[model samples]
Target: MFLQITGYMTLIGLTLYLGLRPVSGRYFVDMATYYNYFQNYSLGAHVTSSKDVVFHYFMKFSSHFMTAHGFFLLMDIIYIYPLYLFSKKYFKQYWYYSFLVLIVSFSFYSYGTNGIRNGAATSLFVLGLCFPENKIKTGICFITAALFHKSLTLPIGAYLLTLMYNNPKTYLIAWLAAIPVSLVAGSVFVSLFSSLGFDDRLAGYLTGQGNLDVPVYTGFRWDFIFYSSFAVFAGWYFIIKKGFHDTFYFKILNIYLICNAFWILVIRAPFSNRFAYLSWFLMGIVIMYPILKQPLFKNHQLFISKIITVYFLFTFLMYFVYYN
Candidate 1:
């Protein structure tokens, strides 16, 4: 798995270096400015009033673009390695789990290279997963994440839910009831943002109200939905077969899916792609534990796994090729 991960990293690095000029050429002036802001924030310059200030402080002290990327890259390493350890705690031959981590890391690295809050927030979220049993520690981690990006506050509730429930049916019913309430609140929040004179840049970005067209690869792709559905079914089957009554992870997955689904209904715009990222991230974990434990899938699983892997890789590569 290490070798496989290394190979993927090498290919990605080589692709970026070779394609840098073309990639940069394709980005619009505003997008380019954001990239410069990311690189510049690493040099102590304030870019925005948003919560990225916390990350800005760390990046500024680093004092170089390579240093900043290197820091986050190291954090990514730290965040993902523990996932392997966690999987190994349950399944001894945990090497295969590394592929799951690589898929997530590479996909995020590809789309989120704009160096905003998304990449940093994702790394912190993964790290929070490692400390699931420690609420105080996990809460601190998420609070730091909220400082970098407010969107992260969504999953912090899931961590708390783990402490609240032990039964699957009860948890599912509660979550279903809560979804409508959250949606109403989110709608009210949007109205508040409007009343507060929220910057047009952020509003445009969040609501997809800008001039940018919906890229082909944007939104919930059919292939992704297909694969995620299969993973959900497979995971459900594995848990039932193993007599694993724990509902925490399942509840988390349900929240992620429901949140994304609601965003699709309310937003009705291209930025729905952002919510799709949450879906993929949660589904990756949902798929991982089952694939590790089910002997029935051990032989035929690679066939299906490779398809999803290649689909994401191709989607990300094309996103860069077209949208840069």
Candidate 2:
């Protein structure tokens, strides 16, 4: 009882710390961009988002009554509160454990700081999926999520398609096929995808034409391919080996597989993590949700203790050692 209360307390403090961070490009780069946008809107500069209209309008509306810091705090809430709600709904008593997994995810902090719109939208996507029975509520959440970040359409569309013809093996096959295709086709895939014009930024990523002020790497990113394979491997072990045929779990696995495969096809693109993140955002949930939901081991608590340690250790090593 006391532990759960403390967990919530810690969550509140963490949220506030992230929300109140200073606006600086050296550190939360997108926060500075957003601050600029907010200032423009506040000064009647007529800001708009052709696709992310809700986001621009929200900025426009918020500019009237809030300081940029407060707006950032609100964005943090939008990015984080949904995770709290979903963890509570799904994990119940052990809600904090699942919430902790989400917060500690490799992509979570970066998204919140660097890709604020995607962060908040994906969190809402997580919350919206919590309501499987309420179609209207789910639809609204998905639509609103897309309006905030159009890239959300990839996962949202994948999820909806999975709902219709969800065969895990089929997605797994597609995911594997993408690897060889990407290896052989190489830059050919990039040019083809860039021509689609889904989003201009996406085009830039595909074509290595990103607008940047710092050196960026572009190549066959085996490190990321291995990282993404974690989900594919874990899902197969749990579902195919251990028989976690939970339809919802299969859907999540399928969603991750589909999106991850699309990312693999564009593995050599600049800032491709932006594409990989569509699935990486689901990694912790993919790996942790099943373990939390089922008593797969005799001493499930002990198992979870070890899993959490290893999980966070990997995140720590990756961020500090590899990334730094």
**CA-only RMSD, every prediction:** 5.9, 1.4
| lDDT for each residue of candidate 2 in 119-232, tens digit (9 for 90 to 100) | 998988887888989999999999999999888999999999987999898888899999999999967877888898668877877776767433577888998988888889
lDDT of each: 0.51, 0.85
Q: For model 1, how does the per-residue alpha-carbon lDDT over 193-215 read when each residue is reduced to its tens digit?
A: 44555456445545567544345
Which residue ranges in model 1 land beyond 4 Å of their true spot? 1-31, 38-48, 64-92, 101-109, 166-206, 210-231, 240-244, 294-324
Kindly report which residue stretches of model 2 are placed more than 4 angstroms away from their true locations once superposed. Answer: 48-51, 213-215
The model with the greatest lDDT is 2
Residue 180's lDDT within candidate 2 is 92
Q: How accurate locally is residue 253 in candidate 2, as Cα lDDT from 0 to 100?
A: 89
